[model samples]
Target: MKLQLLSDLHLETEAFEPEPAPGADLLVLAGDIDATWQGLERFAGWPVPVLFVPGNHEFDGRAVEHVVPALRGLCTRLGIRLLHRESWLFDAADGQRVRFLGAVRWSDFDVFGARERERSMRAAGYFMRLMASTQHGQPFDADAVRREGLACRAWLEAALAEPAAGRWQQTVVVTHFAPSLKSADPRFGRQPGTASFCNADDDLIPHTDVWLHGHLHCRHDYLVARAGRKPTRVLSQARGLVDKGEAEGLDPGKLIEL
Candidate 1:
């Protein structure tokens, strides 16, 4: 199957010209497409199947509990699938069946180690503070964000271990947060307190054939070698815009064959 990958459109501020590949089987929007729910309509008339995963910006100035359900409802009405701790199967053109497992995958502050976590909480005032002020009339504290991350991790682990996971000819894992440190920008990963919220633990790296993620505004496509399993390809296609409304000129969009 040929799948086109795009992310971090931020359409509220930047303009996007969708260049869909001819005969593309699917289009995956990694995250941060827009801040408000109305921005989803930009993708309305596409011909191929659409899959989406929400990013932190989706909940900006809105309650997470409310925005999530509203987005899901809108997705259902539009025939788009919004994945969160969920799985779906697609029949490929080559007569092979492919499975997709996905989640928003929040940051647990564990990627930077214990000492960094302590310093980040002290210096950066905990990662949740980044979103606390954005939430509408609701208390989005550190504890709540931490608990949500824990739940996401638990769900992903359990979902990967299901017997059905081994039935697919190929498996792809999609997330809105960076799952491997290698996929993150070197400059951001070296920062003091900002790195923790930019990545996830590498525990799920071995189970997927292709790891599709978008959080760090950089694109990565490389084989991650593992112990006993085949190398997994990590792809992040984020067309990040600068202050003057121009692309960062990095990896913008990618077409992957599975």
Candidate 2:
């Protein structure tokens, strides 16, 4: 299937909007299309089917408990599929079957190392809380993200472990926070703040056909896998912050064949 991916557009800025790639079978919005979640309305009558997974930005300025239900209502009304700890199956006209699993996959702050975890939690947590979101009527802090991220990781792992008794040809995992450090921009690889954007799930890379992520404001395409396993693609096409030059490499019209 030919698929197009777009994320981190941050349309709340109102400075940019993406042009859809012609002939694309589906469009995957990885996350952060807008902090207000209003930009999604623009795609209400999108030419092709759309799949979305919420990013951290989606919860900004709102109670975490309230965002999902509101998103569900909006997505339902707009005909967009909102994926949150869920899997969706798509059958290509030629009979190929692909399963997509999506979630926020907030970082556990374990991107560095075990020794630095405590420090990562303290640092990454501060960075995340800067979004000023609340959960269950309280600040949604790092510990909250870690709990959620760990659960999401486990859910994806379990889903991938399912037997292919049914006949799906491939699995695609999508999340706002990246699953592996290899997905992070090299220049900021070891930074504590960067740890908030990825997790230590590199081992999971080889288990899926393709992994797409957002949260970083740059574009990337790379291969990752287990020690002796076949490589899988880990890609990101995030149109990140405009002022910091992080959005420099995005190709608004790029598409990938799955």
Candidate 3:
């Protein structure tokens, strides 16, 4: 299967009109295509099957309680599959099957170390200020985000362990947040603020074949070692803030073969 990967189009401020690339078996939008949810309509009736995973931006200014239900309804109406803590199977042209597990995977603020969680929390206040999402009839707080992130991690761990998911020809994990610190930009390496952008999901690398994510507004394509298994390929194809042309290593026509 040749899957075209794209993310972080941020169509809220940037202009983009994309069609499924020729010969692509699937089009995967890793998230942040738009926060307002209107940009997603552009993919309606796309030539190939389109799978989307909502990024943090999708909830900004919207109540956390309402953001997902609204997206789910829109996706159902548009024929797009929105995956979050969800699984979807794709039948490849070669008669192979690929299974995808997706989530926004919010940062746990434990990227540095368990001991430094407090420091990471202190350094990152931007999410609360900007997300502006409400939960439990109150503003969503860091603790809530942290709990949700960990819950995603737990769900993924259990999902990957399922025999049914493992029976596919290949397994792929998708998220809006970086799976490992290695996917982070080197310039911000080890910074407390960087904790908000990625996760300490090194433990999960050995459990899956491929991982796709978008959050840092950059790009990455690297292989991570997996014990007694094929090396896991980590990729990000985010377009970032195109108006500023800051998204590095972006390949809009990039395709991954499974």
Cα lDDT, all candidates: 0.75, 0.85, 0.86
TM, every model:
0.89, 0.95, 0.95
Clashing pairs in 3: none
The per-prediction tally of clashing pairs is 0, 0, 0
Superposed model 2: Cα runs more than 4 Å off: 226-230
Best by TM-score: 3
Error of 2 at 20 (Å): 1.6
Among residues 3 or more apart in sequence or in different chains, the pairs in candidate 2 whose N, CA or C atoms overlap within 3 Å are: none
In model 1, the clashing pairs are none
Across 89-208, the per-residue lDDT of candidate 1 in tens digits comes to 988777878889878887666667766765544544554565553345557655455556778889888877776645678888888888867776765565655544455557677777
